[model samples]
Target: MDVSVIGSGYVGTTVAACFADLGHRVVNIDIDEEVVATLEAGEPPIHEAGLPELVATHAGPDSTGRLRATTDYEALLDTDVTFLCLPTPQHADGSIDLSIMEAGAEQLGATLAETGDWHTVVVKSTVVPGSTADVITPAIEEVSGRTAGTDFGIGMNPEFLREGTAVEDFQIPDKVVLGADDERALADMHTVFDPLVDAADAPVVETDTRTAEMIKYANNGFLAAKVSLINDIGNICKEFDIDAYEVADAIGLDDRIGAKFLRSGLGWGGSCFPKDTNAIIHAATEAGYEPAMLKAAVAVNDRQPERFLGLLDEHVGVADRRVAVLGLAFKPGTDDVRNSRAIPVIEGLQARGAEVVAYDPVAVENMRSHFPDIEYASSAAAALEGAHAALAVTGWDEFAALDAAFDTMATPVVIDGRRIIERREGLTYEGLTW
Candidate 1:
């Protein structure tokens, strides 16, 4: 299959590289010249695990010529399938902003007008349930002057790739969804994903485009709610002086309740969870139904950062002290700092007049855009040095190995938001939810 992916952001770049690795010829189309050049040179434009190796092997010089990138929309005319990987950011009211995706669709549709053969356009970006049928399909039709089911095919194939393990997730997916009302569009989508389905032996879900779009939202919504529910439980456990981990362990023994997302701490924050949850909530409200449980989940997630800071307040006053913040990325194995829990944690510390010094293995440069004046340490040891207190916001693996770094702190009051640190002699440690 010859596939072209539009918008070479995190999802676009990873999907293009992984598609090529699955034995398909892939062309990544992006508006950014630097991103296109980086991909052409076999270097990843984003920080994702295992992406560099895949890009190097399939793209650039001295590699199999299965993958390439281009800035021209004309390059997509030759491909059999085009996947829209543009970002659908949220509006002020938490509704999805589809301007980017609509523009990309219009451009793609205009380019397709030059080709006589039928081409399939797949919606790979996460959007509201009715977006594909209501907004995107119409945009493409209006531009190309072609009937959707007749001249060009349209489908919705939402991506389930996580930031940190996108490559692995794509290669070994638990399920593959192919959503389209047109038979030709659905058939073409299955052909494009047949390699992955056979290789991973994953379940194939065939449904309408609307259902497909809702699946992505429902998936994220459920996971977000689960995390918030546990955090809510963890807060109750804290009131009773009970270890949440112990309670989680006992409850996880039942098959009905799995152990995943059971470690409750500062709540869920990342690109997908926050955006998708809010989008669905807003969409549901617009449809004359209010989702109370989802609203409660968001409320709980919003308060977790303050609760984490409140624990630090119990140990010592940070109004005139140096506070070391470990980890800045939303989660480990990626450098994306969008909607990281550390944001509010840092804000809370600053509100209390604490001098913030933060450190993350790969997120310092990304976090710098958020807090330009705060101190960024070169290493975890460097951040802890000469600090009055330390707060662990992200659960990086290296933070668990620190033994003597606390000795350098002036007061040695440690607050663990992720439970990655251990209590020891000569150090006052507080776990957010133990």
Candidate 2:
């Protein structure tokens, strides 16, 4: 199958490489000349584990020469499957900025209008409900003068790949929900993804466009809710002086509440959860329905970073203290800090006039771009050395080596934001929730 993936960012790049690995001709289209040039030179924009290797393996010339990338919108006209993997960032009002997605759609529609080539348009971006039909489909149909579902087949397939393990997730996903009104398009996509569907035996739910769009929000919101629920439980442990992990351990035995995302931390922060949760709540409210519990979950998760910052304030007296920040990426596996909680934590600590030394094995360069004012250290020990307090903002493995880091710290003040630090002796350990 010939596939054209639009917008070669994280999801787009991963999607292109995965499909190419699965024996399909893939061409990734992007507007940025620099990004396109990098991919053409076998370079990945973001540091996702296994992505660089996979792209290199399946990117250029294969046994059959399947994979290709381009900056041409006209690539969509020749492909059987056009994947819309464009970015839909969050707007200030808690809605998504759909300009890029719209731009891709308009570009494809114009080409289709001129060429009259019928193709399958699959949307793989994480978009809000009603986005495909209300915004994207309308934009395309208005420009093309040909109805969607008739002249050009349309489908919505949301992406659910975690940043670091995106390559693995792409080939082996938990589920694959295909949204399309056209039966032919749906069946054709299933044929291309038949191997993945069979391997996981995951449900291939066939739903309407709106339901498929809602699935992305629902999946991310539920994951965020689990993290917040455990963190909220951590708050309860703080009150009773009990171990939240022990309580979670006992409860997670039940298959009903399986123990994944149950570990407590400084809340979720990446490209997804924060914006998606707020957007879902906002979209629901705008539609005259208030999701009170989810809204509270968002509020609770949002406050988690500050709660850790407050601990820092009390430990070193933020006015004139040297703070060591370990980890900047939202989670451990990827070097992506789009909405990492560490940003706000670092900014908050700086506003309080504390000197910060930050370090992450892979995220240092990315963090340096965002936080040039702070100190970037050579190693975790270097970051921890000579600081009044060290805050574990990210759960990187090097950060988890608390003892060695504590031994080298000038103040021995360790604040475990993710609860990765066990109870250690001979050190000032202030865990946010024990």
lDDT tens per residue, model 2, 310-425: 87767678567778888888899888888898899998988899888888888888887788878898888888787888888888875665576677766788888877766678
Which runs of model 2 end up more than 4 angstroms from their true locations?
61-64
For candidate 1, write residues 242-295 as lDDT tens digits.
999999998988889988889989988889999999999999999999999999
Q: How far is candidate 1 from the true structure (C-alpha RMSD, Å)?
A: 0.7
Could you tell me which residue pairs clash in candidate 2?
none
* Predicted structure 1: lDDT: 0.94
Q: In model 1, what lDDT does residue 104 have?
A: 97
lDDT for position 97 in model 2: 89
Please provide TM-scores, in order, for all candidate models, with all chains considered together.
0.99, 0.96
| Predictions: Cα RMSD each | 0.7, 1.6
Best prediction by lDDT: 1
lDDT (C-alpha) at residue 84 in model 2: 92
